[model samples]
Target: MEEYKKRIIKAIQYIDNNLDAELSLEKVAEIAAYSPFHFHRIFRLIVGETLQNYIIRKRIEKSAFYLALRKNLSIKDIYHQFGFSNHSGFNKTFKKYYGKSPSEFRKLAPENFHKIQAKQSKNGQIDTVFDQYICNIENLLNWTNMHLKIKVTALPEMNLAAVMSLGIANVESSFNTLVDWAKTENLFPGENVKMISVYHDSFKVTPPDKVRIHACMLLDEPLKRQQGEVFPEIIEAGKFIIGSGEVTLSDFEQCWVSLFLWMKENNYSVRKAFPFEIYHTNFKEHPEGKMAVDFCIPIN
Candidate 1:
């Protein structure tokens, strides 16, 4: 298990460093010193998805966040940043996951972007109410020596209804269940919607079977509270280190370890809540080989 863990970490680092270059599962497995056949199975058993699915999800998720926050960037520029060889390929992938063209998602931001009003406590200290920590890669111990450039940012409060899973959560299945329930209940308003997973355990110490996850949403209106169900709650706003790239499930530990190393080295502290994952792409529409999710790590 320890040996597998090391190989997984190396694979994640390779993916992070080569996002803009051509990457193949077989090649990535080679880097991990595993045969493609066994590697693919192990990766899925650990990560819950195939290698290609993980990569596509990370690339698209990264592009989506930039599209939302960096309005000045062009679609073409975003595509190049993720290593799409041409505009057509990027558009197809983007539309498949997001349910809209990049231009469409950008256009919705003006009206749909939820502007969070910064809150202050009467004590005069910047109400650490949603105090968030942001860590850049320069401070990370594991990747500090690597040449990657990374940044961290603070995110505003969001409203969501979530289903809590106490043990190893089948995230893909749980997300589908939530969406189906939301659709049946009209939770999605056709404006942009976000799917988030709040993590309650340190990925490092928590066994995959013992991890907890909350499937949540970013909503504007109050949801009809359900009996025996967790209600919509405000995720206190905070700082987060937002990073993107693909990694197999087996490699998830390395990705998280790298993030935590960044936090510790940067003098930032982790919030007690579990980290949340945002799905920027529509998985149902994308080919199974291509899917993306964005990870948001809350900081203090």
Candidate 2:
């Protein structure tokens, strides 16, 4: 099982690095050191999707991101970047998956883009709260230069004391709640405490009501899980891209999105490990009225 996991990680890396190429089952199977037939079977068992489906999903995801970020790039160029040989095929497939054409999606306001991303249909139904949140996040991203600095480095394993929240829509409230808890437990600003948050679901893909966020503290060593309230997770050692800055509470969402888009542009593929933040200073005590935060994304 361990060997299979290692090979699968390599296979995923190969897929991401060559996403623009014509990837085939046989080629990827060879990369994983497995027969094509066996590779297909095991891949489906492990990934819950066929190899072809996974490839197409990743390509479409990248194309959608390109559509959102590279406003000047033409649809033809975007399609070709994802290895789609023809416009019609790309258009049909993209529209079918996103419930709108690429051009249409690109033209949507940031708020509508969020609604559409959350899979809300355009049947004249409006979600005011969702729209407002997305608009706020987009405004911050547009106002700031998100890609200030990025460095890829090797990271050692880390253990964290964490508090998990479900369906949290307000960052300030949730963050304050976590901080208050840490303070109550006397866990704040200890020699080993580094405040961070682990996002388990992407807002673009997961519904707002289903999102999971883990507010955590860096621990010198692992701690036993305390059932529901607090738990421990080992962040596996891997290659990671790090981005740091003085950012406001609102900047967290924008920072993460920008980091991922940067990764795509730089040809780095994200690994399966959970991405997290590393806080350098207290959120409430930053002299600049912003948190000094470092975003860490696992990658190859």
Note the Cα lDDT for every prediction shown: 0.60, 0.69
Q: What TM-score, over all chains together, does every model reach?
A: 0.46, 0.54
* Per-residue lDDT over 64-121 for candidate 2, one digit per residue giving the tens place of the 0 to 100 score: 7557645567889989988999989998888766666778767762324343354555
- Candidate 1 local accuracy as lDDT? 0.60
Which pairs clash in model 2?
A: none
Lowest summed lDDT window (length 10), candidate 1: 125-134
Q: Give the TM-score of candidate 1.
A: 0.46
Poorly placed runs, candidate 2 (over 4 Å):
1-116, 122-147, 170-186, 189-192
Q: Which stretches of candidate 1 lie over 4 Å from their true place?
A: 1-149, 188-191, 227-230, 246-251, 282-290
lDDT of 1 at 265: 51
lDDT value, residue 4 of candidate 2: 68
Compared with the true structure, model 2 gives a TM-score of 0.54
